[model samples]
Target: MHVQKHFGKQGILLVNLGTPDEPTPRAVNRYLGEFLTDPRVIDNLPGPAQQLLVRGIIAPIRSGIVNPFKPGGSTKLYQELWTENGSPLKYYGEILTEAVAKEMGDDFIVRLAMRYQNPSIADALKELMDAEVSSITIFPLFPQYASATTGSVHQEVMRLLSKEQIIPNVNMVNSYYEHPDLIRVFADNARDLGPMDQWDHIIFSYHGLPQRQLKKGDRSGCHCYADGTNACCSSISRVNQFCYSAQCHATTRAIVAELGLSEGSYTTSFQSRLGFDDWAKPYTIDVLEDLAKNKGAKKLLCFSPAFVADCLETTIEIGLEYQEEFEEWGGEHIQLVPSLNGDPRWIAAVVEMLREEVGSNVVL
Candidate 1:
């Protein structure tokens, strides 16, 4: 009698936040309908209230469904962000998926999915299941751990996997906010814009989360909302280990250190706050105001570290919108640092991270 060995390819699923399929109002409406309704994304409201608010008011108004005569504010921004190939979020995701697949060679199969749009997580998971991979590693593209982001992706993945009869060994990456390769990529991108000393100031802007959501994520009950100052979020600790704000601060520190930026030269702030509710404080707009009006700072460089790819937020909001505002506030130039889109170095870094994950797991 003779026995044969079995070998199987590992599955790698990369999930981004999401993007509208198209730049039109109706498309954005559809996209926001799915995205804003996620309980994790809008955890402050009850399910029924969340549904009603999002469907009845937020989505429709933002997408111009309520008043068709005037185009929604988001519609114009998406139009500006759109390219010949469509949404940069999805396009870059596709490019990344293909690059990772090729780099991993025959040993791995990589798939890309968006949490709330086309190329959904369901279809991507189905493909991996169909391939009968020995093990599955879910790598959410979000660098920081936020219940609304990495947490939501993990929950969705588990929900989808729960229906399968035979589940392979599953592993999910929580966050890589301080990954050396990730930090280096950001620093290198900044360096490419000539010398860093020319800029008067730098801003590290992460997407804002509601303050209520931040408090809700804190299970220890001793931090987050304990103080009104939010000084607790100044550094990472076991008490607030999973806090998004803390992770953002840590990420900024890492990038600043890598770039050899001195203290007081850079500031960390949050952007893209939705609704009137209180969000992470020291908002990016306020920071911009202080830098220009009070400090008389000009020629600022901004880094949106929370987002790995350039989307509406980075390109339109920071690049165009902020630039216009900064100029009005007596600033000379507000240079937007490029994101790690399809750069070969970024591709290599992602491959290295995936290999590390795969190597640590047991195959079949």
Candidate 2:
């Protein structure tokens, strides 16, 4: 390791879950091939099984190269999510990075990297390293903590830095599920939708992870997969602090508190579960169905707190497909609260968090 004693300028790396370079099937295929292959993403599966699933099933179906098992057209969804600029995820990420770079001026070098795909963590780190930044802080854009997302970014950062002869003072943010300003931005987005009473029910849906992943991550073996009991899995304790399910619950609680929503008015669920394996309980689809059918809910508001920017999961999945699902269940509307993509408050929160982690003197 290159051990440099005196510090130069602080380097800030803004990392987000990646997007395909283009919205085509080929692009989507390469993206999934890289993303799903990461051990952090498919942690529980055996290496051979993981490769088999990715190469034989997921990638081929996504790219439309294999026809026997035709999965839904990901390219169409990507087309819907694509804007004048490009993928919403990457577009907003670039805008956010530019905003932060301008805010910090030249003293701090702010670079954006996708955990997978173009502008990857490795290339971005190499850029920072070339700049000879004496210290570095990694800010994974995920609000809630999960090994698959934030943990993966940190793992890649360390793995690359480990090969270097000289290493700078490195720091990484684990999670900011309940950061005050972040909560404010999300809540404010809800508030912008007029009165809370307008909607019959509200749902905070976070990206899902397999329950097995939760169990694997649980250092306190007893704390995870407690049959969805609020006592054990709801509260963030010393034992289950890093649990993705628990933090999702915590984020819901915080945003609801900010909105002054009553206990029964809103609930939390997990989304984007794949395969037959059980994932974080109370799936978003189930919650939406129940709301539309049994609960007599007409209009519903959905918030995806896990994503900082509106992406495929947020825009096409929840906003479009979930809306269709809700309508099929006789629901009037299901409005998705927009993500905190380029919101100034969200940017301010990022700066604040960086300042807190680095020091008070960070030029923001």
Candidate 3:
């Protein structure tokens, strides 16, 4: 390990969930190796053993299966939406980082990394080390918490630094779904939707985790998986603590209050599920189909609160695929509010992350 102490600068390292190096099978395989094999990501498995299993078993199939972004020809209408910016997730992630750096002024260095692929945690830390930055704070860009997502990324980051023998006085933002400013951003999204009366349903769709994985939270009994039947989530002790479902429900409540909208005006569901494993139930496709069945949902609005920027899951899965599904089922229109990308108040939230984690005096 490369042990180092307090130095000239502090760094705010914003680590977003990664994308494949390119939208190809080879790239996806490489990305999934670093991603799915993490013990924190696929908890309960033995670490070294899981790594081997990932290499020997999972990567080959996952490569073909999990390419969130499909390659489309130039003639495809989807190609029309493509821009010089490429993937909106990476595009907005960089924009948000650079914008935060400008706002943070001097004395603080801001950098970003994907938890899985290019510009990785190792690279980000090495940059900080070269810049003589001694302290570091990691803001995993997940507003809500998940072991496979936020916690796993956090663990991998620590693992790389530990191997390098360079552990900075690191602080982490575990979850901020309840952050007042974040709530305001969601409120702004509702207003951006225009006449709310015209919309029959607002769905808060978060990324899903397998039920087994959700139950396997390291926090264990500290959370509420709540069988979703009885006081399961609330009435129980910490049993439901690590449950993403519970947190998504809480986010729905917070958003409702923020928008001054009443209950039943909205419902929360999970999206972007992979494989045949029973992920969190009431699949998004099913929900949209039901809305189509109801036939009165003239307008539909969906929000991906788990993600801060528009990514494949949000843009392609939710926006494109789900919109098509809604149309197929007969819903008139679906409007997806973009994430808090470069928004001024949202910018302040990023700054708040820096100030609270790295050090002080980070203002443009």
Candidate 4:
């Protein structure tokens, strides 16, 4: 039994997509397997079929997929990811939590947990429950609400609580993509890059999804169109209406307005395609290549807004693969503007997210 001690209040859990215990093939395989096999994470797809596709196919494909993006592949990319502390996500989570604690100052217990692998959700929740917290606010760190990402976290938390002997009052912060503070963070990133004048195009690349899964996500039965809507590619209820794309566009618009960039100077695309099914539209790689081939666009500035912290997808895939591909297509100077990992403004945003959701007195 989780021995109850002095009763306090609820806690805040900043849940993120976790990293493997180590950066190795075995661990990565296991982590990838857990992440890919989730029906909700992959969404709209039925069981055994998904497994046959992921486990049977994607499993063997991992080595090949990750090879070109690994640290061995790009030293500059790896350097950008490195900090004196550890993995960028883990480090930034700690930093944001600490900053949040600074802002909140111990009124509420603030903690961080990954959806899978080290600092597991169970461990974080157990700690909170041990403290006899009255409630919990879950901030899954995906800006866009996708069934696969935020929905996955929600279900995982519920699943964990269902198995628990005691439950705490919990409020989930589903999406803050439209939150002004978050917009400020993105704006800061864009401004930090100086003028948007040098770049030929601004592409906001999001994590891709199978188009069939996205279509089936239309719970409202009216989300099949391409326009950015909450009903697009999610269970269009009160919950996942604000997913990655909707938020991505909102951020893009916010940044564009902030920078006063021209109408056609910026665009959005999806990256990191896994299987051969229809995912989100206007794939990033295809867009990059086309921009180079036709528009004669050379210099580019790419952003992965779905991720607040740098990771393999952003660092390796986009910073390396996408950059290389751009250069291959005669495009030059592909600069992957770094994410707002622990940026003072981003730290402020995280703090604000906690304070607004839970209260001002929560632990940072």
Candidate 5:
């Protein structure tokens, strides 16, 4: 008797942070509750305390559910961020996923998932398993490595796969902070805006992580915040290889090198900090203020390398909110370089990265 051999396609799971289902207070509230309560996000807090803070207080307040008279802070931002096609993050993820799938052809199956909310990791994983892929590659859409983002996504994927009776070969791309293709795409986007010299100053604003969390990731303990300075994060060493701030700096350096930006012509700062705890320093807001007020900066260009796609952070926060504040400080314009949202080059870069991952894996 002859037996049939089973051949399976490779699986690609691309995950982004997430967005609310709707631009409503309740939806935002639910989304925030799930996001903030993750231990990796609010790692400093214990489980019960974190739950209370997120579900009982923080989420309600941000969603504006506690006070019906006022529009929710995040909800209002989401409302402004929503487009005719819906949330840009999710929309771009969908487009990118479809593009990657088509590019990969019949050899691979690609799925897009959000770490939180709709099109969840669980469902994505289920689909991949159902497809009977021989292997699955998990790619979190964060340029830099952070416990709260990439680490969290990996943990969730493993947790879901742990329940399965048969688990396929798994690969996770932790951080591609200095990938040449990624840096080129960003530089190309800025070039499309005209010339690098046109802007008074360039700002590379990355999402902020609490200083305490940064230190927690440092096994050396003495590496991060040792001398009450960010000197340790200036360069990436084995001691700080996974350091988020160091990775962010590295990303900026790559882009700066590509654009031939002068040493003082560009600044690296952190943004979207929460709870007023000491976060990675030289906050973007402070940097903007100094440029406009003291340095007499007229035109500014900002790049949010932390985010691959435009969402509330890039569109509303940097594009609108920061622009407004800069103008208040007498600045002329704050140009936000577009993110890698379905750009043909960006799609090609992603496909290249995924192909590299798939090529490296042993076929079953």
Candidate 6:
């Protein structure tokens, strides 16, 4: 048996969607290699088959290493997103973790980890385990629950804990889609962009997942309507609770209500689809195109509620790339509301979540 040392009574592990350590092609390749290889992420085939596809096809195409078609494609994206504080995603996560740790005080030791990169989940758990924590609470940064993101984090946590004979009492925050505090933060961010009426249209663009993933998550089979309307995915109830698309819609509704936005003032779409075996309908690009071409909307405001912190997807994909596309389509301006990355409100929300989970007896 391993030596047991009393380090802390409780440990908090904050998990975020990973980012590359640096903006180099090698770093991007390494990060993507690990992230895309996960079964929960790809999910199209069996383990060996997935690995073959990832190592052979996806990784090469993304990193632009093997083939001559697009060298440093991902690397270029990373370059544009690089900040003085390093990757904005990781930097914000570190700040948020520190803020939460301070809020939690001495009782709970907080650690930050990326699901796919440096300060990995495996290493973070080991640190907590070494501390001999009686209980461990895992709070994934994903506000909305998805198998590929939150589910993958849970799976990895369990996989690591399985090796330890003395497993700590584990608790995971599955999703906080309608958390009032979270909704307030998002609404507040939108308000910071000045007036809602000043913008022609608001787009709540969330990360896309294959339709198959949605089907797999559908326990009721009746949930996840193909039309992408409020009738099915609007409410947060037991039947369609685990549905990511439904949860995304729920988040949009909550924020819009918080911001006093009326129906038809905003629209929801999915972004970042890969391979495209029919992802969540009405892609963000398509939505932007329609708004500019048919609707004659000039200025657009976008919100990516799927991410709590700004990453390449937010900073580059929506902020830079989407702006360029919209401009090409005769749109004058495209603004992305900043993510709740270490914002005072967001920090308070996280602290509140931890307190609620840990209980008053824990002495936080």
Task: Name the candidate that leads on TM-score.
Answer: 5
Q: How many residue pairs clash in all the candidates, one count each?
A: 0, 4, 13, 17, 0, 0
Candidate order, TM-score descending: 5, 1, 2, 6, 4, 3
> What is the C-alpha lDDT profile of model 4 across 62-150, one tens digit per residue?
63234535432223333455667767888888888787767777667888888877788889888888888888889898887777778
Model 1 misplaced regions, further than 4 Å:
1-6, 67-70, 362-364
Q: On residues 1-364, what C-alpha lDDT tens digit does candidate 5 reach at each position?
A: 3322237888899999999998888889989999999999998889999998789988999899887567689989999999999999999999999999999999889999999999999999999999999889999999899999999999999999999999988999989999999999999999999988899999999999999989998998788989998888788999999999999999999999999999899999999988868999989999999999999999999999999998988999999999999999989899999999999999999999987877776544
Candidate 3, residue 37: Cα displacement in angstroms equals 3.1
Which consecutive 10 residues in model 1 have the weakest lDDT in total? 1-10
Please, what is the TM-score per model?
0.95, 0.94, 0.84, 0.85, 0.96, 0.93
Which of 3 and 6 is ahead in lDDT? 6
Per-residue lDDT for 41 in model 4? Answer: 70
The residue-by-residue lDDT of candidate 2 on 1-364, one tens digit each, is 3334536677999999998898777778888888999989988779999988997798878766564244338766787889998888888898899988888877789999999998899999999999999889999999878888999999999999999999988888899999888899999999999999999999998899988888887786776765555456668889988878888888888888898999899988888888899887789999999988998899999999999998989998999899999999999898899898888888888887887876633432
Sum up the clashes in candidate 4: 17
Question: Which of the two candidates, 3 or 4, achieves a greater lDDT against the reference?
Answer: 4
User: Which residue segments of model 4 deviate by more than 4 Å?
Assistant: 1-7, 44-57, 60-84, 226-240, 359-364
Number of the top candidate by lDDT?
A: 5
Q: Please report, as a residue range, the 10-residue window in candidate 6 with the lowest summed lDDT.
A: 1-10
User: Which segments of model 2 are wrong by more than 4 Å?
Assistant: 1-6, 66-72, 227-230, 360-364
Clashing pairs in 2: 1-165, 2-165, 2-166, 2-167
TM-score for candidate 5, residues paired by index: 0.96
Error of 5 at 252 (Å): 0.3
* Ranking of predictions according to lDDT: 5, 1, 6, 2, 4, 3
Once fitted onto the true fold, the runs of candidate 3 whose alpha carbons sit more than 4 angstroms away are 1-7, 42-82, 218-223, 226-242, 358-364
Question: Candidate 6, residue 218: CA error in Å?
Answer: 1.2
